[model samples]
Target: MLHLRAVCPAERTEAALDVLRRHAGATHLVLLRGAAVEPPGDLVEADVAREATDEILAALCELGIDRDGGVTLEVIDTSLSDHADRAEEAAPGDGSDAIVWEELISRTGEESKPSWTFQAFLTIACLLAAVGIATDSPVTIVGAMVVGPEFGPLAAIAVGLVARRWDLVKRAAVALGIGFPVAMAVTAVFALAGAFTGLFDRAAVFGDQHQVDFIYDLSAYSLIVAMLAGAAGVLSLTSAKSAALVGVFISVTTVPAAGYAALASVLGEWDRAGKSLLQLLINLIGIVAAAALVLLIRRRGATDGVTTRPLSSG
Candidate 1:
């Protein structure tokens, strides 16, 4: 279930009410007239089935509540009202399977933005991965993966493709395009510094690193793993079960490959660096392809039982 709070202008209140009343998935509706101080409008709140979110939000958007006022949707973690249960039953699809398009787009769009925090996490993840590669430690590699933030923009790219949001696509692309190179370059510098201090050995990185050897090994299995992880990552975001994302994070070798590429380049092992770069590219491409596919399937399912007329008209 989801909780919707909307501030609607007086003129559009009736229209918003009518739309909410017409939807069987909406319940516990409350209207506080002239309660919005900033917008100087009425505050409307309701509990809605997750599956009906897209449609109800579309209707609100059609009424210009989103443009003239504001609408906020929040997950109802524990709704004790029977009306909420009835609303869920009245809705068409399972809540977990439903794709809230507005919510998904808003979330991915925000996450995809190039921020200092995003760059910091990516750089730190790469640095950790550099340490992992130098030590040939799977544990350190997994830790680096967990700390990596690359998946946000990657997932956003897939969402943008499906939703036809070119702005989002561009933002995600810029984030990734700039982020990875910057992170790799920083890691390369760190590697050079480590080498100067005798803390990193080029021969160790190029030979007998079985535990972390897979970072440079691009194979069919690598593609398959990336595809699965991508699918799972999208599902985790859309389904609001974000705990699953941690598993997805560690399942792919994106950060580790970048780390290896940077380190190999620093060590002047051009061949190994190229192979690691190839591995990174394969994982990235595989993830985006698979995530797009998953989102398309979910989008189709969301549209099956719901009409997009409101969004279309708007």
Candidate 2:
């Protein structure tokens, strides 16, 4: 469900159009031939195309049309014929007006950065968990789970693995790595400050906190959950359906473990802190490893028609 438009020279228009038309998924294609004033040599008319499925889009990208003239490609989501008509009517008349994948991923990249907003969200989420534990409030604990910002790094790691961009991988790793310690330190300072101020009790913070301690006990289920969530995260990134990703974010314990570690430090429960830290590490490692594995397998499958390759980077 994507709408694509391209503006290329008249000479290459036929080949491009043929490429688009031969694909069965491309249903509506309108080719207008002309030249733009700024680029005098090239054709100015718009060639509009729409894909009903993502597979078709991938196929077209794999074709990789290399042309000298200016070309703009766009993808639009259409659920019905009426929507397609509306997309056609709304097509851009000029070179500036076009749909492109790079643009879509760029906007996504901007919103998904590890910025102060994410820091604030994680801080608040941890605070909520601390308060929830103190007040014995299950609702607040779940709210904390929902508010945590654990998905950003997970996603960055996944994207880096898929695109084979180590710089992105390192940035995401650094951001996530630093973010956890910062959050833990801040939580400790605040929790100790609260304890001294008689706002909360050390015992209340660390006493009999098994629910939060659940993070430390790693099992097969842990690996399974990480793999499932990581795969879903990548799928969410590539596909149009994004709502399910939020639930996946909340289900993972990366942020909560960091919060608990900080809270444990404030309470002087070093054992709890150590356990939580271990859990956090296990989950983070599990997620990164599983995500990398999944992407590798998927890429190999796409290229070789084999989905499960050996789990070695080499």
Candidate 3:
């Protein structure tokens, strides 16, 4: 899954090889005794490995090669292998030492790279929600939830915090903050137009409503739902075995809440509209806070020192 080639001192070759064999997830091991030579990538390719990079890197730190000594660690993605005879070694302690903060940050960056398609998806979700609100159709409201793409940035923000990438955090925050308001504004315009046309004021709409039909109900369940969604979102980003993020995205009601709020505001139900807006705000704050907290915990395990690359002026 990962290809690693390292050049180290003749004396430390065995030790480095031991670490590689023990924690690098190398099916086959190779070590060349020479001066510092860069790996295939000019920079250290730490994230290429499918497994155990974090553990191997920690072993390197423990072996004194990371700090005092001069050994270059290079990793890449390839199926190639070079076998080297080595003495038997013990396995790392359940491979807990690897943190790979750089790799995590890089992944977050990759995830945060936005596309026009996502914007289109958000627009569609908002419009679908407006239609649902206008027609009093809960099924269409759920459709809107399924269509929204807010989870990408939500998960991206969580990963950024775990990786200590403030730039990513800022970008994700901006995307969410701006996007939600934009969606609400667009839906609000539609709601106002629909209200003037008597679409929302149709007979027998509010007369037959049940107690549970309050779209603006900002009860404990509202906060609980947001909390659960936030937790699942972060977990989906971190774990390799799970790809349940899309489901989480569909289950979250943020866009629906906003659309409903806009519709209610247009219908002169300011009380319900304000409650729905508060619910939306609560969801956003809860998700962001939870994501940041999770990331902070993950960052504690990171061995890579903080990188201070200059921001691009363009």
Please provide TM-scores, in order, for all candidate models, with all chains considered together: 0.95, 0.70, 0.68
**Candidate 1 overall Cα lDDT vs. reference?**
0.89
For model 1, how does the per-residue alpha-carbon lDDT over 1-314 read when each residue is reduced to its tens digit? 88999999999999999999989899999999999998889999999999999889887887889878999998877989888888899999898899988888778878888899999999999999999989988999999999999999999889888887777788899999999999999999999999999999877766777888788877899999999999999999998889999999999989999999999999998988999999999999999999999988878877433222212111
lDDT of each: 0.89, 0.58, 0.60
Candidate 3 Cα deviation (angstroms), residue 50? 4.7
Best by lDDT: 1
lDDT of 2 at 274: 82
The sequence of per-residue lDDT tens digits that candidate 2 reaches over residues 1-314 is 45555554555566666665655445456765564444433342223432222233344344332233444444444345753455445432221222223333343344445678877787788777777666666677778878876666776676566665555566667667666667667777878888889887877655665554555555677767876777676555555447877867766667666777777677777887787777777777776676667656644433222111111221
Residue 306 accuracy (lDDT) in model 3: 43
Question: What tens digits encode model 3's per-residue C-alpha lDDT throughout 160-196?
Answer: 6655667777776777777777777888788778767
Order by TM-score, highest first: 1, 2, 3
Per-residue lDDT for 17 in model 3? 68
Error of 2 at 140 (Å): 2.1
